[model samples]
Target: MQKIFLVLLFFIASSAVFAFQSIESDPIAALLRTKLELENPTEKLEVSGRVLESDVLVHRFYADRDFEEVWSRNGILLELAYEMRFEIRQAKFDGLVPEDYHLALIDAYFQTFEANKAAKKPNEAGELVALELLLTDAFFKLAEDLELGKVDPAKLNGDWEIARKTSRTSYLDLLNEAIAKGEVRQNLESLYPKFTIYKKGREVLRVMDERAKADTLDWKAVKLDKAIKVGESHAAIPVLRERLNYWGYAKSQSVLDPKLYDSTMFLGVKEFQLRNGMEPDGVIGKNTAIGLNASPALLMEKAAVNLERLRWLPDTVQNLELILVNIANYQLDYVDKLDTLFSARVIVGKLYHESPIFTAQMSYIVFSPYWNIPPSIARKEIIPAVRRNPSYLSQKNMDVVTFSGKQVDPASINWSAKSFPYMIRQKPGGSNSLGLVKFMFPNNHNVYIHDTPSRSLFSREDRALSHGCIRLENPALFAQTLLKADPSWTAEKIDQAMHQNKEQIVSLPRKIPVVLLYLTFWADSKGQAHFRQDIYDRDAEVLAALKQ
Candidate 1:
């Protein structure tokens, strides 16, 4: 009975596609015209919430065609419907839940249509209309999610004001174009970022979900009272080996020296450490233990959340020179045409002063840049420090200036005043907060990538010690790379400009796009996934929103 039903669905589905290809007089338009003229418009669509507005779009679309069935005509689904169904089933490849796009409802309608055909009974006219309406709704819903991510950026984080503007293309017109070109799947797929990392994330999530269901994954914390060094003997060595093997870090079992931390186990632990955003020291420490203990499901959830964040990026990222800064990873990648030219370590903002996730165009580079103290820092730190020590400004290569650019004597100002409304500008020198050079991308955040005198911080595994700005380890090298398009700015010229004690601005020949994103989980080109600590704890909020 099951085999018969399956064969029946395939036969009807195939017939629908064949009929669509054979029709020359726009069968959908004729059916829609006949349905619209009927006294009863009984197929009231079942859509609510944000999607309710699509009803007007759907009605206008059919009315424009004189009430023709778009996806089907006379109870026969079209090739467009089959293509849409296939795309909907593969929505996970785009970091979307298939269920969210009404896949089950669509399958149910097709199954019912198949049963009616097999029984030699006509499906209710209202039911046929409902099928078309729901399928149309699914297309729009899927398109919306693909174009603009599931959550609004502004709602999630007010500082995330860098999302691309909504496309002005009418959903109905897009559907019509897709149907005409027989490219429903292509249309939907074109709306997302063309990065392979997203596909890897989906694949990882699938494996994680399977592991979760089988209960084969273990996240039990492995704690040793004493640190285990290479070639050291420990009671927990066997358990550590088991855990490492389960996570695919270790390939072979060592029974001869099972209780000893040998070279093989040491290398596996280092690789695991690297994947977890920790310094790969090969010594099992507290942080390594914590990383080993992270639940696979939790890591999978992070990957899923980050995949959605990728969807929030502007579509321009597909074909542009992109400077992507992964805040969680504390690394920046200079990419053009999907090829990563180089990567550098970076220092992001501290937890209390979180770095924002946004996109902007890098227009220019400022050499020997002055750091204008932010009002909050001036009020909280500079003023307090100056009050305690009268020579604080001169000692730190800083000067007091009025809002109107008039220089003021730091010693002359009243230190005990309640309000300090003056600007504290740091001089362009080695001790300046902005180091020797800064990459300027004008935005409301007042944040830019710059060099730092505190170069020692870059060596640390966790380099999140900034005042809401990124500090590049090699700012001069980055500046030279950015000016590669300009023949005037040679490597020697860039170095000379950086060493100068005077401020100078050099605009780029073409603006480079920069994206500051906080992705806790990232997959490299080779499909090796890495998970970072949610320094800002954004994963939980994003996961909660996805649930809603």
Candidate 2:
């Protein structure tokens, strides 16, 4: 009896699978069934030499329509095809490849369809059906890629949390609704990121593209052996002025000598340095020369890669009052309502120990926080220093503690042992690793923003000097900004708490989101293009995947 029931269930499922592909009195439906059932469906479904990328979506789309032609009625293509084809061609402006959506094949088929209509010939076998399937698949692909990003950031270990713009609408239903209302273009446009940065980047790319097409990209190069200080004379000064002018920075030609770095040129050079993430000193140094010599092609490539990164972010990042730290820029910004409330320099992790890109919420602030040295650091750095200096622990105000965190005598342990089992924690004081306060947003990586005793590191232009944590330049001011809503936690009270020499936790009234990103290229609100070196060397990998 059991065997008979199992056989009945299997037959029911088999009949359900075959229900959609049954050939009725329709040539388009029959052709679609034949092509989709071929042994190699990918090769069989090829439309004018372009194999379909979304075969599964095509199957579902047609099955829902009972395999009827979507782009045509009575073997004549509809006006929606024209609008969709135009959108496919314009996909290039969104940092996407137009040809990836079968643009060339669609063009070929479209021209032949028009020619056939003019000559009074009938639609060719499977021609309209192919267009129907391709159009639907293209629409779905664009919607998904724009809404959820084309690249899988998780595959690259990028902790990107992308949320859909229309969480309540299904893609299939959205596509159907769009076609029914003739709102195809509006539907596609709504999926792109709504950030102002994204819009500015698109405009920048448009200008760059037009320049490339016209072959009119004005760029210049500079070569110098040593730093050219203000009022110095060098043959490359004229080239430097031209380079600055190319990016909207104008420096008047020196009346005395065109090669002279005059006062006017010095200010322009300082502006260039500031824009390119360098110290704004009026010196034509090596790094500034690299920036001056950057070609249009390099900027375009970096812009494309950073645009892809922007697609991976959640749109709400711009909608909230948040703390944003761009690792590549070595800076932190406290922003609300799309305006930066405060900005400060930051020290991030070194190249060997890269600061990860992730998001968490700041829930509390710890005044006079103890520095819990990580196990890796203890094994690699502290133990070696202790081995070299007998009183290293005492000098640094650190203690040898058990896993449970009870203090132990440092001198009682064997200094030369390779397999040490202990944790090193610094006491809360002026010389503590964490200076006076630490903002908490507890994550598995043990990373947080805090004040550091090594305050001099903040003055350096390249502040990637921490051990997988972010060190703030002004923690006191940051605290004041965060606790401004509560009048009790004034600047003086916050200061006294920092120097109390006791660990005290202050819970925030509400959790504010903090996002750490690594965008190497972006445009400021004033339309100035800012560029930074790929400090962690992540551009090549992301760009390769993006183009692929």
Candidate 3:
């Protein structure tokens, strides 16, 4: 009888201890249970008006926590709230606006709670659960923008097929994973671009912003009727010197004789011209004037726009052998592991025929290639030319060919037709439009990097003259570089093939990836910002989207 009484006493004492422990250690759990019914998570989310992209994810998220507080526990999640606040504030560095994510409201709510943690009423704390839901919603929205970009390039430009992350974890899952691993910063950083270029651009922005704060450059347009070249003095020299100093091109602003366009000033002007995508001839012409007139704020806006454009690129560019074309800059760079193996000035499509931005695998290099003139070009250009002169095709080394490889007499076909059912192919020769070699990357756009007979056009500062194809400055050099993998094709052999005066197809042993991109503003490895003309007027559209 005494043993049974002792066992009952011990059971009662154990139960009391367990209850006290639950009440003391988990006050938030006890309070939430009394204040809110978490089992009906659908209704809870409905009341908050927070709908996730995936309903299943929402249901699973709430089910995991039984609709309990995932973000906050005692008053508010002070540490996490502060972390989010910091990220929001740092959004500008990433070319993002914090106001877009309700940054002010989140920070205000967190601050109020942090200051008065003990003053939170039970009902008020329960009501603040909505803050938890709102924050989670905001966080996921932020992540999506940072990871996948806010604007869809495909929607803006029809030809842009930028690969995006289709599969991603739920916001709840991401939060839990971060918390479990105790790595908030790492998780947030993962959402941004993996490219080092993006980071370098941010650093440049930071430095430029600091400089702007110290003294905002108030550069006025310095117009001159005549061109200002080296070894010649001009009245605009003082203004030009001031402008160069503001742009960090000139060494000092405290010159006693700023009016003199000395050799030192000439060097600075040349460097400025080069960085601004103009010919570094130490000549202050119309193009150089435009660069000097662009204020620091305008330059920053350009950089920000290009940074957002960078976000549209793939997170992982696994293509080791890359042919990257910067259309805005009118340059092509063959890069491998952050090293530029080969670079050349390229003539891209004109404003009307803007080059389509995309990526593809180059399969082959054709030697002394025949130029198959596009149907649109033939209808718009060839037909008209033939009408004016019947000998146009023969003079230009062009011939009419049926779709099935049958040669058709140019005189036999009516030149007055609105469209031609046949293709016009240029015969392989020095007079042929496709010079000597062409890089073929099979794409629907029918755009190829090829040699051109108009080599003098490459000397122009602005080389946007092609219809839609990329015209390489040195095709033989490009061919030699690409065929280096094949032991059978030597540099001498490549040169011989190009000068063979007959069409010959040479397939690449291994495929090389090619990316045609547009970047009006970017930073070099040294964090120096480079600006280029928006030849196709693409920067304004992206800037408008960024503002939106």
Model 2 ranges with Cα > 4 A deviation: 1-30, 37-44, 72-77, 111-125, 157-169, 216-224, 235-238, 251-258, 315-318, 337-339, 524-528
Q: Give the TM-score of each candidate.
A: 0.82, 0.86, 0.85
lDDT of 3 at 331: 92
Ranking by lDDT: 2, 1, 3
Q: Which portions of model 1 miss their true places by more than 4 Å?
A: 1-44, 47-53, 70-83, 111-122, 177-183, 199-215, 220-240, 254-262, 285-296, 404-406, 485-493
Task: Please give the lDDT score for candidate 1.
Answer: 0.79
Q: What lDDT is obtained when candidate 3 is compared to the true structure?
A: 0.76
Q: Can you give the lDDT of residue 31 in candidate 2?
A: 81
lDDT of 2 by residue, 1-548 (tens): 99999999999998866764455567888788776666375353565556676677777776787777667887888888899899887776667777778788788889999999999999886788778778887888877777766777777754434332343336777787777887788888777777778768867777777756754545645667999998889988877787777766664453678888888878888888887899998788888888888777767778878877887788778778999999999999999888888899999989888999888899999998889899899998999999899889899988888999788898899978878788899999999998999999987788999999898888887788988799999999999999999999998999999997679999999999999999998877777677898888888777778678
lDDT of 1 at 122: 75
lDDT by residue for model 1 (1-548), tens: 99999999999999868655544365445444454445245544443222332565666777765556767766677778888888888775554677777778778888888898799887665666666767777788778877777877677752556765476446777888897898997777676656778767777877777776766645666776877899889887787777788788988764687789888889999999988888889999777776777776777777878888887876777767889999999999999987888789999999888889888899989998888999999989998998888889889999989999899987788889887878999989899988999999888899999999999998888787998999998888888788877778898998889888789999888888899988888787777788888888788877877757
- Which is the leading candidate under TM-score? 2
Deviation in Å, model 2, residue 520 alpha carbon: 1.6
Candidate 3 C-alpha lDDT tens digits along 410-441: 77887787667899999887877888889999
Residue 356 in candidate 3, Cα distance off native in Å:
0.7
| Candidate 3 residue runs with Cα over 4 Å from true position | 1-63, 68-72, 114-127, 157-159, 163-171, 219-226, 231-239, 253-262, 316-319
